[model samples]
Target: MVKVEIVEEKDQQSSANSPYASTSSSRHSSQESISSISSELSAEETLYDRINALVDIVPPATRHRISTKVSKAVSFVKTGGKIMGNIVWIVTTSALLVGLPLALSLEDEAKIVAQEREMMAQQQGAQQMLSPGSAYPPPPGSNQTPQKGIVPPGF
Candidate 1:
């Protein structure tokens, strides 16, 4: 319970004879009034206080049910977050494990194709050299017939 009092304003000349007459006394009274106003403002219900008051109005059984539902909702959100995090981790790990090896294998296959092309080019150049109108003629005493069944060294 609280009680409030209202005082009527008095003329300055009349107040000049009162205890609040001196400059220091007037300042002190002003400070007191400001502090009292601040205290009254502070005494007003805050948002949290109002919410608590509303909650107190509900029946105990209803309050319990509401709290339980809220707790479950919070738990569900936390669990869903953890599950999403795990899914992301799994996807990233799979990409590293499977995709990395696949990329490396593709690179190796490309190298093999390049090597095969180089081998074919070399074979073509050797055949050109052995042709009749070749840049270099055969030695004077050697047989010019093509050799039939000899495989190249690195084949």
Candidate 2:
């Protein structure tokens, strides 16, 4: 029983030191500090207002020069973009115009090649058929008199 009591006391002490321990005063102080910091920041001038204040310190002539430079830069960017777009359009149109005819010509050439190959094959077959060795020899007793202008079997 005594040991159990001592363990309970130790558990309480350990929990008090742990982060999960909720102390109302500490939470209130943290919330107060956050609110104070937020309020202080809100009281400061906005970024745009600060920039305008800084710009006010510059001489009028210098400000005018800076504005002109900025405007020129913007216009240059716009003009470059337009020029690039036009170039892309021209190149695309040229490719389409040139590629169509080239593709058609290539197709025609391929067809011509195929036809030539077929003709060559047919000529080879005909030559094989006309070759004397391709025919069977005449039967043993079927000899006929040879006539003038007639080609002989071996010829």
State residue 20's C-alpha deviation in candidate 1, in Å: 44
TM-score, structure 1 vs. true: 0.45
Q: What is the Cα-based lDDT of residue 93 in candidate 1?
A: 100
Q: Please list all clashing residue pairs in model 2, or write none if there are none.
A: none
Clashing pairs in 1: none
Candidate 1 contains a number of clashing pairs equal to: 0
Per-residue error (Å), model 2, residue 68: 1.1
Q: Over 4 Å off in model 1, which ranges? A: 1-44, 118-155
* Model 1 lDDT-worst window of ten: 36-45
The global C-alpha lDDT for each of the candidates, from Candidate 1 onward, is 0.81, 0.76
lDDT of 1 by residue, 1-155 (tens): 89998988668877867775666776788888897764332456686876777876899999899999999999999999999999999999999999999999999999999999999999987886667755454557767854556554557
Candidate 2 residue-wise lDDT at 10 = 48
